[model samples]
Target: MRVHSLFLYPVKSLAGVEVSVIDLDDFGPVGDRRWMLVNDQGEFVTQRKLPALARIGTGIDERGVSVHIPGEGRFHLAPGHEELSVLVWRDWMNSLIGPKQASAAVSRFCERSLRFVYMPDDTFRRVDPARVVDQKRVGFADGFPFLFANQASLDELNSRLKHPVNMRHFRPNIVISGAEPWSEDHWQYLTIGQARFKAVKPCSRCVITTMDPDTGTKDPGTEPLRTLSTYRKTQDGVIFGQNAVHQDGDHLSVGDAVIICPQES
Candidate 1:
């Protein structure tokens, strides 16, 4: 199928930047989910706890990454370097032990126990499991580098919705056009060019999906998630999208053809 759009989130939970072309590494997009807001204890924070993160703006250029908040002056992160920094989400979680004292520190910024940290390119860190050799540096994603979605699936969901929704709501790294609606759900492995990705798990739906990336308004009271919940619900919860682990290193662009390999039963 054809790719309709490409997106990368330089900072986790903040708005994503649309790109004309993107380079794919082992995890996903090169710069996608590279930064995250953590608390003093190094715990992860997101819109679920603080919706205002939606207000943060981000831009990338030759100078590196730039972030803009309403009253706060713009902050820029330097490009990847040879040195490395070790930042952990678990560290931020431990800093929340002091009741309101700790909450106060974070509340000043947002409702969640979250702070911000940036990793230099030279930093060599392993994925959480500590076993998956993350030779390819990653930023702030839970794991994996890329998240791919099918345009046909979104179109089918929109057909069922009262109003048409744009691809922004789903926030995917890759969008394939030829596949059937939700066909990605059945994909066991996908090969795009020379890159290989294995569908490891079904991504659980969260409040973030309901919020409009453009207006930051909640609007998931419709089909797709609703329809998916009716049947796609796992024993745990309603699931959408597949989380993939990269098997090969390849560069992905706007029009790359994705080949889906069927699951052998």
Candidate 2:
């Protein structure tokens, strides 16, 4: 198997950019989900409540990051010196608040009050201790440094759906091809290019998967999820992809061979 695609989400919950090559830092992919949106309560907001977020595009350059929302025009966010505490899941993380202009743009796009924030070098949010013992840290991602998905698993899910959802629905960081459907479930460790990653947990499916990443519209029947409930249902939720943590090495590129490390008997 080989790396089929690479993705980077400069801001959390926005449309992701597919890249040919990416550097894997201790925080997962460089510039991946380092920025995010939050409400007045300081809690993070995502596509789960606002599907329109899927239409918001993000790009980063030497200056800083830019957010583009149709009609609302483009707004740029530079790293600020001010730090604010924001909530993601149950953790309260310190983040560099984006400039007022960027916050206003995001609020208008979401049609609600919101603030833009970025994780700085000082803010080290540890991975849930129960999930992995490595004490690794992630950016604004849900819980892990990386998310890996097999194309064959999506192929199998598409075979069961009427509309046939694509890989974008899951928004994984690393995508692999040429593996049996759901074969990642058995993988304990994998090597892609020079990077070694340990599969930490099976990513749980949610309503976000039912929404169209391109159009920001959701399926009325909540497809994929509805169908997944029948078979992919677990005690926690419906499982789709695998969450991984970087263990060693660096850099990933498309077409790099993926070697599944053998498990000890």
lDDT of 1 by residue, 69-96 (tens): 6455466654332222324544221111
Best by TM-score: 2
What's the lDDT for residue 145 in model 1?
A: 58
What C-alpha lDDT does candidate 1 achieve relative to the native structure? 0.65
Give the per-residue lDDT of model 2 (tens digit) for 1-265: 9999999999999999998998878788999999999998889999999999999988777776788987778888877888889999999989988889878877987789999899998899999899888779999999888999999999999999899989999999999999999898888889888788888899998889999998889999998899988998877679988999988777999999999997521
For model 2, the stretches where C-alpha displacement exceeds 4 angstroms are none
Q: What is the C-alpha RMSD of each candidate to the true structure, in Å?
A: 5.8, 1.5
Name the candidate that leads on lDDT. Answer: 2
Name the lDDT value of residue 36 in candidate 1: 66
Off by over 4 Å in 1: 79-114, 120-138, 220-224, 263-265
Model 1 lDDT, residue 200, Cα: 61
Please report how far candidate 2 places residue 246 from its true position, in Å: 0.8
lDDT of 2 at 196: 85
